[model samples]
Target chain A: MSVRHALLGLLSEGPKYGHQLRQEFEERTGDVWPLNVGQVYTTLQRLERDGLVESDDTASEGTQNVYRITGAGVDELGIWLHTPPDLTSPPRDELVIKVLVALRMPALDVRDVLQVHRRYLVELMQQWTRLKEDEGEFDFALALVVDSELFRLDSVIRWLDAVDGRLKRAEIEPPVAVPELPRLRRRLAVRR
Target chain B: MNVLELREVTKAYGEGMAQVHAIENVSLSVERGALVAIMGPSGSGKSTLLTIAGSLEEPTSGEVFIEGAPLSTMSHNEKARLRRQTLGFVFQDFNLLPGLTAAENVSLPLELDGMKAKKAHTIAMSMLGEFGLGDRASHFPDQLSGGERQRVAIARAVIGNRHLLLADEPSGALDSVNGEAVMRMILNACKQSGVAAVVVTHEAQLASWADRVVFLRDGHVVDQTVPPPTPEQLVHTAQQR
Candidate 1:
C-alpha cells in the first residue's frame, strides 16, 4: 500500500539501485504486485527529498543512483511495521451496494441477484485455488499470497450466504408488477 | 458410450396429497473420462440424483442405466455385482474400516469381488503409492491425517478397474488446504484412469474442478454450464503474459 515505506524498508537492508529494489520487492511479495522501475525511482526521489533516504550518485557510474536508508528511514520503517492498519470504517463494496439496490427494485428477485454474484465470486476463488495448486506449495511467498486471497474471498462468500439466510428468515418478497415495456414483459415471462 | 445415464427419472416419497418429489423428470448423461459436478442448496435432490445413478435406490419411475445396461432389468444380486465391478463411491466421512490398515481398506473392494488377497494387496499398494500415501499404507485410518485418509478413500474408490466414481462432499470434513488437495486427487484420478465421475458439493469452488456443472432447484435441473477454465489453461495464459 505505502510504496514509500516499502522502498525504505528494502533500503534498510543495504544500498540498492532502482532496478534491484523493484525486483526484490516483487520477489518478496510473491510477484502479486508488480512495481515498475520508474515508480521505484520516483519513490526514492521522494524519500531523499523527505530526508528519509540518501542517494549516492558517486558510488555508481552512469545514470544509476544507489540509495540507502537514513537513520530517519529506519525509525519510519520500524513504526510502520508495528502500527496496525486503520479498520474502523467499513470500505465501500460494490457487491453490498448491488444487494441493497436489488432489494429496493420492485420486479427483481434479490435471491437470484445474490446467487449470480455468489457464483462469480466462487469462480474467482477457484482460479486462485488452481494457481495455488500448481505453484503455491513450491514457493512460500506465493503460498502466503494465495492463502490470504482465498480467505478474503471466503469471508465475502460467508457474508453473502448470511444475507441470503436473513432474507429467507424475514420472508421478504419483491412486489409483483407488470412491466410497462413489451420487451421487458416478454423477458420476465420467459424467466418465469 | 455414456458411463451413467438417467432418463426422465423421478423419485418420490409418501402417497397422494402428502407425496413429495425429490427429483422430477430429471435426465442426465455422463460420458466416460468426463467429470460432472452437481450443485444446489439444501433439499434440492442432488444426493437423490446421485443415489439413483449409483443404483443405491430405485427411482419411483423412469429408467437408470450404467454402461448401456438398464438397471430396471437387473435383479438385486446382478445390480450388486455391477456395483462391485464397475462403480465406486466416496463420502464425506472417509468411510474406511476402522480396524483395517490403509492398504487393507483399499484392497477390500477387490477382495470382495473374488480377487486373491495377494493380488488385491499388490494393486492397492500401487494405487496408494500413486496417491502419495505409500509410507502411510500401513497406518490405520485414525493414525492418518484428514487429507491422507481422504486420499486413501479415493484410491480405494478408483482401484480394481472401476469405471465410475461418485463422491458426495468428499472434502467436507477437511480444512480448505486439505479439501483442495482431495479435489486435485479426484481430478487426477479421473484424468489418468479415464473414469467418469459425478460429485455433489455445496462449495462452488470445489465444484469448479469438474468439466460441467449442473445446478438443481426444487427437483429440477435448473441450469447447466461449463466451468470457466482449466488449470492448465490458466497456467498457459500466465506464461504467455
Candidate 2:
C-alpha cells in the first residue's frame, strides 16, 4: 500500500540493499503481499530523488548500492506509523453496485443475486480459514492477516443479510410492466 | 459403503391444514471419511435434516440408511444399539456430566455398552492423550476451559468405534480462535479415522473445513458444492504470483 514508507521504515533500521529490503518486507508482512525486487529498486530511486533516503554507492563491494534512511525519512516514517488511515469515505464496492442495479431489473430477483454473491464470499472466507488453519501457531503475523480478511468478509455477509431482512420487511412491489424501449423496437424492426 | 444416506427424506409436523414440512424431499449421502456441513439461516431446517440423518427422529416420508441398514426396519432397541455403537454426537454446550471426571465422561458410552470400567477408562485415557488432554482427564467439565471442554467432548464423540459423527454448532460457544481449533479437530477426526460427519453450523468459515457444504432454504436443498481449493493449492497459486 505505502511501499515508500515501508522501504523508508526498513532503511531506518540500518543500511540495506534493494534485494534485502524486499526480503524483509515480505517476511514482516507474512508473505501476504509479495514485493517485486524491481519495484523495490524503483521506490528506492524515488526516495533518493526526494531526499528521504541516501544511497552509498562507494561503500558497496559490487554494483549493488546500499541505501540508508535520511533524517527526513525517519521523520516521515515516524509520522506514518502514528497516523491512522483514512476511512471516512465509503468504498466503491462492486457487490453493492450489483445489488443496486439488480433492484431495477424486473426480470431479475435481487434476493437470488444476493444469495449467489453471498455463497461466493462464504467460499472465499473458507479458503482463508483453511490457510489460517494450516499456518503454524507461532506465525502470528500471517494469522493476524488472515483474521483481518475473515472479519472483513464476515462483515460483508452481515450487510447482505441485513439488506435481505430490510427488503423482506419493506415488501417492495415488483414492477407492474417491463418498460418498453424505443431502441429495442427500432433494432427489431430493422432486423425484420 | 456410504456411512449415512437419506433417500428423498421429508419431515413434516402437525397434520392437515396446519402441516409444516421442515425439510422436503432432501436426499444426501455421506461416504466414510468425508465431512459434510449444512448451513442456512434460522428455521431453515438444517437441524431437522441432521436429526433425521442421525435417526433421532423419523422422517414422515422416504427413508434413511446407515451403513446400508435402513432405519425404518430397525426395532427400538436395535436403533438404540446402533446409536450407541455406530453414531456419535457433539453439541454446542459441552454436555459433559458435571459429577464425572473427564475420563469417566468420555468412557461412559463404552461402559453403558457393557465394557469393563477399568478397560473403558484405559481406552479413554489414551484417547484424551491423543487430543492433548491427558492431564485434564481427571478434571471435571467445570474445571476445563471452553476449548478444552469441547476438545474433550470431541474426544468422547470419537473415542470408541463410532462410524459417524453428528455435530450441531459444536464451536458456537467459543471465540474465533477456539472455534477454528474445534473445526481443525473435527476435520482431523474425519480424515484420520474414516468417520463420516455431518455438521450443522451457521458459520461458513467453519463449514469450509468439510468436503462438501449443503445450503438449505425454507425446507428445501438450495445448493450443494465441493469446498473451494485446498490450502496447498491456494498457497501454490500465491507463490506462482
> TM-score for model 1?
0.85
Clashes of each: 0, 0
Indicate the fraction of true inter-chain contacts that candidate 2 also forms. Answer: 0.44
After superposition, candidate 1 runs with Cα above 4 Å error: A60-63, A172-192, B230-241
Model 2 TM-score, all chains together: 0.88
Stretches > 4 Å off in candidate 2: A12-14, A49-52, A60-63, A70-72, A136-139, A171-192, B236-241
Q: Report the C-alpha lDDT of model 2 over A1-192, residue by residue, as the tens digit.
A: 899998998898899988999999988777878889889999999999999999986764667898999999999899999999998554568988788788779798887888888788777777877787678466888888778878888888888877777667567664466444325556667987
Q: Each model's fnat?
A: 0.20, 0.44
How far out, in Å, is residue A114 in model 2?
2.0
Q: Which is the leading candidate under DockQ?
A: 2
Worst 10 residues of 1 chain A by lDDT: A174-183
- Stretch of 10 with least lDDT, candidate 1 chain B: B232-241
Q: lDDT per prediction?
A: 0.85, 0.87
